[model samples]
Target: MPRIVLATHNPHKVEEFQAIVAEVRPDLDVVAYDGPEPVEDGVTFAANALIKARAAAAHTGLPALADDSGIAVDVLGGSPGVFSAYWAGHKKDSAANLELLLDQLSDVADPHRTAQFVSVIALVRSDGTEETIEGRWPGRLAVQPAGPGGFGYDPIFVPDGQPADAERTVGEWSAAEKNASSHRSRAFVALAPLLESL
Candidate 1:
């Protein structure tokens, strides 16, 4: 099978991407990148994704896929968009980031707690060609974190389309369910056709 480097050192991302990619391109192998991480100084998700993808492709001489994703609260004017991972500090503490976000929006009413999970996946071929695809999962933030299935803001994010009286956070969903309907999955789906050429 062909191999594609996924530009990330995070194990969670590696496993998640493997599951998502397997569904669309079972023949392709998604490998974790052990190369040096480039400075993601870009202000947007697409820019940061490309930076990583470019670095991975240069290091591995293979097609590289990198994604920059975050939770963007509508009430915050999309703040913490590119800063999602470092919301609390440069440590990239998931719990701290979640706490800080919830505290910031503590006063916001339920109807005003609208938010969206955004993901941008960039693909870089070894030959230097590059492309980006984006996906957004709209939802509202819960008052407190719930469930234990996901990382980062998943526990507090109640995805849309759930029964109003029985809404469930992404953290409450099974891995299979999340893999089928996450921002990453959506972005990867859009990039699937492009992968065929790799």
Candidate 2:
């Protein structure tokens, strides 16, 4: 299999992207990157993803894939869009971030609690060729976190289109189900064809 570097130290992102990419091109191998982390100072997911990918590709001289993802609340004016990981503070504490978000929305009505998970995936080659794609999963925030599956804001996110009687948060969904419909997966759906052409 052809090997490529993935520009992230996060195990969750490595696992998620590996699985999602494998679904499209199992012959490719998504390897971990060991380069220094880039400053994700970009204000948008696509910009950040590109920054990481470009840095990795420049550092390793290998095709690099990167992703920037976050949960954006409709009422928050897309706040925490790029700062989702550090929503509570600069610590990037998932639990604290989740807690702070929950508390901040404590007074928000259920109807106005709408939000979406956004993912932007970037790929850069040794020659500096690049492309980025995005995906969004529309959902609403639950009153409180629930279920034990998934990481980040999954516990508080209930996707739309669920049956009224069988509602479940992203945190409650099976890995297969989540992978099939996740924002990352959707983004990769657009990215996979580009990979094939490369």
Candidate 3:
């Protein structure tokens, strides 16, 4: 099977993307990248994704896929977009980041707590073929964190499409459920056709 490198050192992302890709293109193999991390100086998600994808493609001499994703709170004016990981500090503590976000929106009403998970995936081939795809999962922020699954802001993000009275956060959903309808999944679905050429 042809192999593609996922431009990330994060194990969670590697597992997540592997699962997502397998559903679309079972013939392709996805591998985690072990290259030196590139500076994601880009302000937009697409720019950051391309930066990482380009670095991985150059380093491994293979086609690379990279995704830059974060929760964009509508009320906060989409703040912490690229800075989601380091929202609290430079340490990138998930708990701290989640706490800080919840605290910041404590006073906001439910109707105004709308947010969305945004993902931008970039595909870069060693031969200079490059493409970027995007996906956005609309939702609202819960008053407090719940469930024990998922990573990052999953615990507090109540995705749309659930029954209004019985909404469940991504953290409460199983890995299979998340992989089927997550922002990364949506973006990967968009990127599936491109993988056929490889």
Q: Candidate 1 residues 61-132, lDDT tens each?
A: 999999999999999999789999999999999999999999999999999999999999999987889999
Model 2 pairs in collision: none
How many backbone clashes does every candidate have? Answer: 0, 0, 0
Q: Tens-digit lDDT track for model 3 on 1-198?
A: 999999999999999999999899988999999999999999999999999999999999999999999989999999778889999999989999999999999999999999999999999987988999999999999999999999999999999999978899999999999999999999999989998888
Per residue, candidate 2 scores C-alpha lDDT tens digits across 1-198 of: 787899999998899888888899999989999999999999999999999999989888889999999999999999779999989989889999999999999999999999999999999976788899999999999998899999999999999999989989999998888999999999999888888754
The per-residue C-alpha lDDT of model 2 at residue 35 equals 90
Candidate 3 global TM-score: 0.99
Q: Candidate 2: which stretches are off by over 4 Å?
A: none
Model 2 earns a TM-score of 0.98
For all predicted structures, in order, the TM-scores are: 0.99, 0.98, 0.99
lDDT of 1: 0.95
